[model samples]
Target: MSELETLNWQDWDSVLVVVAHPDDAEYGLSAAVKEWTDAGIEVSYLLLTHGEAGIQGLDSAETGPLRAAEQQTACDIVGVNNLTILDHPDSMLVYNLELRKEVAREIRIRKPNAVVLSNFEVEAYGGLNQADHRVAGLAGIDGTRDAANPWAQRELLDEGLQPWITSLIIITGHDEPTHTMDLNPESVAAGVASLEAHKRYLEALPHHPKPVEFIPEVLRTENGFAKTFRVFGV
Candidate 1:
């Protein structure tokens, strides 16, 4: 087996996690994110949407701001102060050059050594993944390439965004994870708090599980609390 089959990178100073909506990271990755923050690593979250359409029966105009505020609070709980939310239409994301360019631009701006994203599989985590998730995941994967190649996203050059090659990519929710990192109780509790911070969104979600109960279960593994990932470019 290759060494990458058991990968663990501890030298990173900066990381950027890009996601499709609010609470995406908090679903399970927040515990790990909190651990990184505690280690003094710079972690920023770049959301592709405001999650305006996340709430049922609520107008997107209201839902957008509400979700944005909730996501902000969630970030604060996890020690992630730098949050960026794009205005891409909720539930209508497309994997196009426009999306790629936007993600690449953010990569250039953030200049993180590592980029984190979630599963992009058509069917993920025991259900069909959201369209925005697949699109956003592709944006993170391909956008990293676009950001690395000055010739790919030529428009970014005009905007003074330089090419940036991420040293690693960490993809959560892979069927065959390359690595698993243990999490402490403090970090897991922070994750629970972050998820709970989405008060309105969680309430609006149909039959949503309770954060205090749900987050801990999600983080549980055979041995102990942990987060798994499929690492690339390690």
Candidate 2:
């Protein structure tokens, strides 16, 4: 087995999953998340947007709330306790000071040892891997750094959120990956089931790019056995 495939991950105490939409975490990491939670690790979620722009037949006014509620349901299935939605407009998410400060504040509050996000460079998976995804990823990287900078969000510091940093980052859906989480047969099944919870959001309209069969296959091909990530310097 490759080093990433064999490395043990039972020591991590907390994990923060940051993704572009509501069901993104369930689609990619729910199985692994279950493993972490079962191991006593605190698992939290940070969804960058409501995916309001998604869905074909419905208007954004209607689709947004439906998608948001669907995402919340998915989180409940995975045993995620802390849920946060940036609520940024779907297709228009941008990388900026305001967004950066928001993400940084979450980092400071959670202090997760490991962070997970969609691959900024992925080309196959359409929506989750967008300009917004890259923007969110960059914000997360900088936020972890700025979390410790005394000047970066002094107001937050005053509230006692304090400076904190994640020790590692795990990026999904890359052609080449640096690490992998062994799913075991049960975990893999759980992951697949969790993805199924987003049934409505994935099958309804504009967002359902891939059918059911294709979804798992794509996940297995793009993010199976071992996932990939770039570790930022400490």
Candidate 3:
């Protein structure tokens, strides 16, 4: 296999991570978030759903707010202070025009150099990619384009949102990654803590794997801990 390319962190001053649900970023990207924040890069999170249906036997009403709170704590651990959780139904996400416009609005508001998202592919190395994940990723990709076009979402412009285009889109959980970012020891620790912050969510899982055990493996690189992404230049 060809070697993965190195992501040039210096080129990005800020990033807006758009994902389907809570704890999504913590799975693998939080380490990169910690690393970037340590370097003084601004990072924000935009969750399309609160992951209300992630746990079985849990009412979505209660689970929604609970997961949101957990996500906020997770973000805090990873040094992300800005977070927005939209009220989209879990497991029923659709990459429709409305969703695309919503994501575009956030992009215009945040004005980041790049956007990060989970993989949109049908299957991942672990198993079938969740429906919400796939939909959100596809919407995120289109949203970037919509944000750049003033005519695409004219109502947003009327509402005082200006068109903005990010330089790149970075997708995690890809079967094939194009770029990798090495994480420092501090970042690795912070990443572990970030996932651990999802206490209730992890507990609800049928199998509870400690964050430290899985995080290091997910973030592993030839040199050390790292995070990988499939980058698309916009």
In terms of TM-score, which candidate is strongest?
Answer: 3
TM-score ranking of the models: 3, 1, 2
TM-score per candidate, chains pooled: 0.94, 0.85, 0.96
lDDT (tens digit, per residue) of candidate 3 on 118-226: 9889887588888898899889999999999988988998889999989999998888989988888889989999999988898988587799998888787777888
Backbone clashes per model, in order?
A: 0, 2, 0
Candidate that beats the other on lDDT, 1 or 2, i.e. the better one: 1
TM-score result, candidate 2 = 0.85
Worst 10 residues of 2 by lDDT: 221-230
> Candidates' lDDT values, in order?
0.88, 0.71, 0.89
lDDT of 1 by residue, 136-215 (tens): 99888999999999899899999999899899988997777878788898999999999999998888766888989988
Sequence-dependent TM-score of model 3: 0.96
User: Between which residue pairs do clashes occur in model 2?
Assistant: 56-206, 180-226
